[model samples]
Target: MKLVVQVKLLPTPAQAAALATTLRACNAAAQYTSRVAFERNVKSRNELQKLCYREIKDRFGLSAQPAVRVVKKVVDAYTALHAGIRAGYLGGERSRRRVKAESKPIAFNTSSAQPFDDRCLSWRYDAGTVSIWTTAGRLKGIGFVGSADQLATLRAHRRGESDLLFRDGGWFLIATCEVPEPEVFEPADWIGVDRGITNLATTSDADNFQGRRLQRYRRWHGRKRVELQAKRTKSAKRRLKARARKEARHAACVNHSIAKDIVAVAQRTGRGIALEELRGIRDRVRLNRHQRAIMSSWPFHQLERHITYKARRAGVPVLLVDARYTSQMCPRCKHTTRSNRPTRDTFSCRLCGLAGPADVVAAVNVRDRARRAWVLVNAPVPMAA
Candidate 1:
């Protein structure tokens, strides 16, 4: 499994300036390459590299390695755009539009992160620093720190590339490390996880991770944000933006904690995890004004992603099944009706008179779906009679 370890860097003023210059040069090169490629209808990475390699170095005054990464970056961007188009996530004409718009260079922010590979970047674990190649020169001994676990991964499996990021008045090294995937295990049973707005996650096995505090936090922040927006002052605007980020950070921390606990439960129980595939759910579901606000801001996607990676790293398989009718369908009676979910939290089966927490019932349905899928895939074909 490949994971990113973000380590905060403490750089001197001169080193920071050099990093800024290097990143700016890289972005400029990428923009120029993009412009030329789009104009000439050049989409191939090799072709672009052949065309713009010398031009970027000569025009941008960048060294060999940074020049390579710059060209690669442009090619990668085009590749991603094409992939998105194919996946239907992006409009077919988006790439063409972007190409046509390249006549005017896009204004880049100061924090455009630059990528560095082994050729241009080196780490000194003993000194707790890294040496990076910059347009000005090689900036050495830039101090960095990470969690003990992250540092261990750096010492053990640090591979591939790292990005230089500047955010919130601090520099960070986002290192990509290739770690060994956990050994695959055949789960004896499966646990279903239903993610929601009220409860972050509820398991079929009767574990509920509450989101009431998180909701309170969001409501408080939302009110503050609205107040700040109305102020129309520079400080108010700044504080509003900061509050948005703070809310996001808080949610992310809570999600991480919840995912960790869920994965730990799965590992302890020797069970795989089953999750509902809720992609594009917000657009699909109809909600009232208050429900819309809460549901719209729900971080179900983030929680699912966190659970997935954590489960995979822990050797527990995570399955995503169809979420349709999960909340309404009764697990005991196998009856499907919207009335089964009489309220947000309560689910009562109309046929069997069985009732339980709405989220848990939904989770049980998810688990059953996964179990059926596994059985179908693994069950042997019947011989002709």
Candidate 2:
């Protein structure tokens, strides 16, 4: 599996300036290349490189590899834009967002991240430093720091390109690392995880990851955001952005903790993980105004992603079962109806009177579905007569 390890760089003032200059130059060159590609109606990498390579090198003062990377970046931007259009992410053809996107060439931010190949960047894991090509010159011995696990991963598995990015007044590098996945063990049973806004996650094992604290945390942040917006000052805007980043970091940390515990249990018990297939969940469900805000801001997908990656690393299998009626179905009697869940927290089957917490019931249903689904998945196909 491919994963990214991000480390913060502690560059000297001189090195930082050079990095800033190089990044700005590369992005500026990318914007110019994008304009040319738009004007000439050319998206092919080789053709666009041929047209802009020499000019970008001469005008932007970039070396051979950086020049090539700039052109490739421009082409990639257009490719992604076209892909988004095809996927209807910007809505229908006549929608304002879609029209606006198609009307102009894609632009790159001046501070956007730039990818560096081996020719432009080299790592020194033993010394915890890096040597990188900059517009000023090659900067050597720029220190970096990361968690012990991340440093170990980088030393053992780091490969391919690394991206240089400036964020929150700091320079960082995100390096790709390819790690070998362990062979999956046959599961003795399954653990079903039900994701929700209020509870966050409820497992068939009856474990609950409650979101009450997180909800209060977000509500406080929301109130602060409104206050800052009312102030409408530059400092307020900066503070607002900081708070948003902090909130995201907190949510991600919570998810990582929850996923780690669940994956550990699954691996220990020799059980597969079952999750509801929740693609397009936002589009599938309707909510009131207050509920809509909570739904939109929920980190259900991130939690699921964490679970998936952790499971992969632990050699535990994961299954996505059908989501329909998981909450409404009676796990005991096999009865399905809307009335089974009369309240948010309660689940009572009208037929057999089976009762439990709604989220746990949903998780049990998920587990049952996965048990059946796995049989079909591994079943032998019938031979033709």
TM-score of each: 0.88, 0.95
Best by TM-score: 2
User: Which lDDT tens digits does candidate 1 get at residues 1-385?
Assistant: 9999999999999998888787778888888887887778888888888999999999999887888887777777777766765675643455666545444433345477778998899999989999989888888889999899999998898889899888777889898889888886888989999888888899998799999999999999988888888989999987887788889999999999999999999999899999999998987888888788888789999999999899888999888899999999999889999999999999999999999999999989999999998888789999999
In model 2, the Cα lDDT at residue 251 comes to: 97
Distance from true location, Cα of 266 in model 1, Å:
0.7
> Native-vs-model 2 lDDT?
0.95
Poorest lDDT segment (10 consecutive residues) of candidate 2: 102-111
Put down candidate 2 lDDT per residue, 174-251, tens digits, no spaces. Answer: 999999999999999999999998899999999999999999999999999999999999999989999999999999
Q: Residue 154 in candidate 2 has what lDDT?
A: 94
Error of 1 at 188 (Å): 1.1
Poorly placed runs, candidate 2 (over 4 Å): 233-238
